[model samples]
Structures are given as structure tokens and as C-alpha cells.
Target: MRFKPLPADFYLNNTVEVARQLLGKTIVRNYGKKILAGKIVETEAYIDKIDPASHSHPGITKRNKPMFEKGGIAYIYFIYGNYYCFNIVTERKGKGCAVLIRAAEPIEGIEYMKKNRGKTKSVYELTNGPAKLCLSFGIDSKFNSISLRSSKLYIAEGKDENFDIVTAKRVGITRGTEFEYRFYIKNNPFVSKSK
Candidate 1:
């Protein structure tokens, strides 16, 4: 199927708004000869200096340089020395804001996702978290700083459906926890956590 990536302008909005609007969108990974995709179910916004939990809070460095790029690019980072978390850069360049793709519902290439995740008990467990979603989609540091407008990966439109969105505080962070920047589709089983 022909999938068009969201325009660069789509991610130039406020980080929190971009995070909320990402729900129900599809993240596509062009893996080799196969195509893997999922409907975005959860996201978390991290704003520059305003968010102490943001990697760019300490100012741009080699590791977080991708987060400082213009919007509509990938800002993948490794965590706990085990897994990679995928994020989409948002707002203008130097703003250092991004939207973390927390979870996604498997929408295409289920077999590929199952094999990548390895030994998952069910489909719900395949891409229910940021790390799992990255593993299942084969996303890593190599994808960081790449333009999402075109390449091996991109975010596309999902099936037409309306759903309620739930806003909650960002998780897995010790600082800036008071900001309600996390957003997810209400009652989505694939959401990593519900508030």
C-alpha cells in the first residue's frame, strides 16, 4: 500500500498538541522487503528547558543533538542500556522539543512484529511500550536524526475512526512529573498504561 508521511508542518505545532494529535496515526517502518506498521495509541511530550526530564534540558550535546533538529525528524535514544525509545522531534529547530511514541496498536505486519518481539504471550504485549515498539519495528540509533517525511520510516494516516483522548502526567520520569503531557486514546488496550 502507498503510505504518505505526514507533512513537516504537521509536527511544527506545540509539543503537547502534537502528542495528542498523534493518537490513531500510523507509524510505518520499511524493513527490508517487508513493511511494518502500527496505529499510535500513546504519546508523551517533552519540551526543551521547560521540561527537566528532557534530554535537551542540559543543552544540546552529541547524544541529544538529534532532539535539537527541526521538527519532523526522528530523535531515537537508548535507555537502560537495553532498549531504544523512539521520539518525533517537534516545534522549530533549537526548540529541543519532541513527542515520545509511548505505544502503538499492531495494525500491519503482525507476523514480523511477533518475530521481532520474540516470545510475546499475545499481540497486546508486542508494542505496548516505547521500547517494545522500537524493537518490534526495528528502530534504533541509526534512525535518529533522519527525516520522517521520507525514508525507511514515517508516520501516516490511520483508518478513519473517532476516539476519546486521555491526558495524563508523563511516566518513567523523576522530574517535571506535574506536567500533563502524556496523551493516549481512551480505553485502548495497546496503551502502555492508563491514568
Candidate 2:
């Protein structure tokens, strides 16, 4: 069954723990009269200066200001000059920690996602990567710093009963590549570039 949107307190935990706990959460996007939802299957943690892969590693800037906010806010950013990536601020305010939502299994509004992504091949193609998921859900830089508890976009609880989660080195990065911060559901086909 679908759950109510998560509260801001739900994100006020350690960065890594938040990433792990988000494994089965449902990310909901309320666009107009339609609802776009997906079950989070993969995530990666960026912990302050300790994690060189994090944008806030060098301290807060205009672009990464949202990362310095309290947990439960969006930190959407543009990359490759072509796609936008979505991240959720984690930990307490001024922690500069966040969790990158790497992938998710499409659940609701599959048709809307398919149309947004211009994809019709398979469900997996709808949200198999950070940028891809944002594209599929119509998220962009404009969403940066928005409250996750808002009705427009929020994360809801899910069937996090017993899904096996595996941790591995984060992908598509050069610095801080040795940290095994990436977490994904074991055997989940929706994971982005899983091993």
C-alpha cells in the first residue's frame, strides 16, 4: 500500500543511514492533477568534507546552497549540460550532507514518466539513473532548495520489509571513489548501473 509523505524529521539522520533507509521509499511528484511515483532502489551518500565527491566538500556556494540547509529539501542540479540530477539534503542544518537518488522502480504515473522521458521500451528505462529519473519526473534546477515535505514533491514510506541492500563504491566519479557509499537493493533491476 502507498504511504503518506515522509516528514522532515525522517531525513534528520546520518547521511549514510538516510541513504540506506531510503532504499524502499516512494518518491512522489504531484504535477498538476497527475501523480508520478517510484520506489527508490539505489542511493549514494555525500558526507560533508569527508566525501570529496560531494559538491559541498569545498564549502557552500550559490549552486550548492541547498546542501547546507536542514534535511528534507531538494538540491537539484544540472550536469553534462544536458541533464539534471536530484539529491535530498540529509543530516542537520549546516552539515553539508545529502543523498543522491540514483535509481528507482516506476510505480505510479508510468505513462507520464514514459512520455516525459520519451521512452517506451521498458519500465526500467523510465528511471534507471539520477539524471534519467529527474528527466522522467520533470525535475530540474528550479526545484532546488524546495521542501521535500511539500505536496508538489515528497518521499513517502514504502514496503521496506526485507529487501536486501548491497553497498559498493560510488559510480561515475574520480575523487572519493574508494568510499563504499553507494547502496542498492540486491538483485533489483531498477538499480542504476549496478554490479
State how far residue 31 of model 2 sits from its true place (Å): 1.5
lDDT of 2 at 89: 97
Q: Write the per-residue lDDT of candidate 1 for residues 139-173, one digit (tens) a residue.
A: 99999889987769999977789999988988899
Query: Pairing residues by index, what is the TM-score of model 1?
Result: 0.97
Q: Candidate 1's C-alpha lDDT?
A: 0.91
Q: Judging by TM-score against the true structure, name the best candidate.
A: 1
lDDT of each: 0.91, 0.90
What TM value does model 2 have?
0.96
Q: Model 2 over residues 2-99: C-alpha lDDT tens digits?
A: 55888778899988999999999999998789999999999999999888989999998998999999999999988988999999999889999999
Candidate 2 overall lDDT versus native: 0.90
Off by over 4 Å in 2: none
